[model samples]
Target: MSNKTILITGCSSGIGRVTAKYFQTKGWNVVATVRSNPEAQTELNTLENVLVTGLDVTNENSVSTAISEAIERFGRIDVLLNNAGYGSYGVLEATPEQVIRKQFDVNVIGTLLVTRNVLPYMRRQKSGLIINISSMGGKISFPLGSLYHGSKFAVEGMSEALSFELETIGAGVKIIEPGMINTNFAETVGAAFNVDPTQTEYVAFVSKVMEGLETANSNHSEPILVAETIYEAATDGKRQLRYIAGADAEKIIAARKQLNDDDYMMLIKQNMGL
Candidate 1:
């Protein structure tokens, strides 16, 4: 990994932050992006091989500028990690159009914009990796998370298509599907929905579901696990389109493959105490 340039988004916290540090420790030239985090910047700036920048994935200008700056600094981008996304927990009926659009903007369109900016450089080099951080939610939907699930599902579909498109081109595309990891993700998501009081009809149910997510996240795998998975996907010789990071993600993917939609919903409802 030494001397290789890897650019990662959403590096202020959670899996992205960990992955950036991990790659730097392995001697990679890391361009770590954050929306806003003074502490993260201060820490990463102290590192010899890291260049931390402010990046809002939903903004085309910000994404383009970040990628361009990274290229200018590092000469080329060897790996592009699309890990910037937030979860919006709400029933489809209760979720507003704005909320849905925001979710898609960050998760789906943001990924596309960043990838588009970075691909030309990769094509010129004729060797690069594009890794998208999806979730078990990408494959299986759960109650009170329709908007979030929808965004990840888009990621899953887009990644598959992009994998086929990039295969013959020398570049590669991979999806990292991780289940509930011990991070501030759930709290952040809960906060997103909590502020929207207009969806009062499903408040009770949504609250219960959010509680369950908090509990599940407590015993979840560490962010380092996902970081390691990203590293493998970026550097591994074999071309694997999807890599399930945690045991829970593997189980969920298996269940999604085996069960019918109705059966899966029944199981999800039962788990959520719905």
Candidate 2:
């Protein structure tokens, strides 16, 4: 237990940062990665039993180097937490094709590449876990966030299929569907929007939705809650596939399940005053 290691991506902040620290607290070796320079990972750098490194998931060299470095340091990795992802905001029509490509590159392709790299080791060792950090957004869509939802939906689908395949090798794969958490996600998503300034037709609709999202953010749950759920998913020996991280996540997922697609979409539009 004390020597167990978990390699997590996107450890710069939010759920990734918290989960890395949380696992370290339980006496496990933690390999945490940030896209920025390793010297900038102040908090993680100071922690004992934690290895802070640079990893840009969308970059092939960075991803391979991170995994190699983690294994070289710890000897083995017991869990791989795919916590690196961001929301791509704006209407689909307004979003550039390059933005869509980058969005999927990080959220979907990065996840695939990392998992592929880790599986060989896990398969040889006959044990491992992969916890993908998804969102309620993955299951439920919203106005003007088509790209974000698309990436998450891709994550969910891939994780689902990989779970069955990995289980054969004594490994596990699970999804963490977190609701809006208190994080820099809002600011990041705001700055990440690829909307064209001249696209005034979607302006009003996007603004209303953004306002509602801001209100939601103000009331969002703590990131530590999602981290705790990540822990649950890792340690829970049962072959469960998905663990909803917050009360709101559970509520929204349940609501979506109870309503038809058209009804859910209509309700969402009404909430944004469309």
User: Which candidate ranks first by TM-score, i.e. highest?
Assistant: 2
Residues 14-59 of candidate 2 have per-residue lDDT tens digits of: 8899999999998899999999888988888999999999988888
Which residue runs of candidate 2 sit more than 4 Å off their true CA positions?
none
How big is the positional error of residue 98 in model 2, measured in Å on the Cα after superposition?
2.0
Q: Which candidate leads in lDDT?
A: 2
RMSD of 2: 1.2
TM-score of candidate 1 to 2 decimals = 0.93
What is the per-residue lDDT of model 1 for residues 111-188, given as tens digits with 9 covering 90 to 100? 999999888888888889999999988998777777888899999999899887787669999999998898888778
Q: For candidate 2, which ten residues in a row score worst on lDDT?
A: 210-219
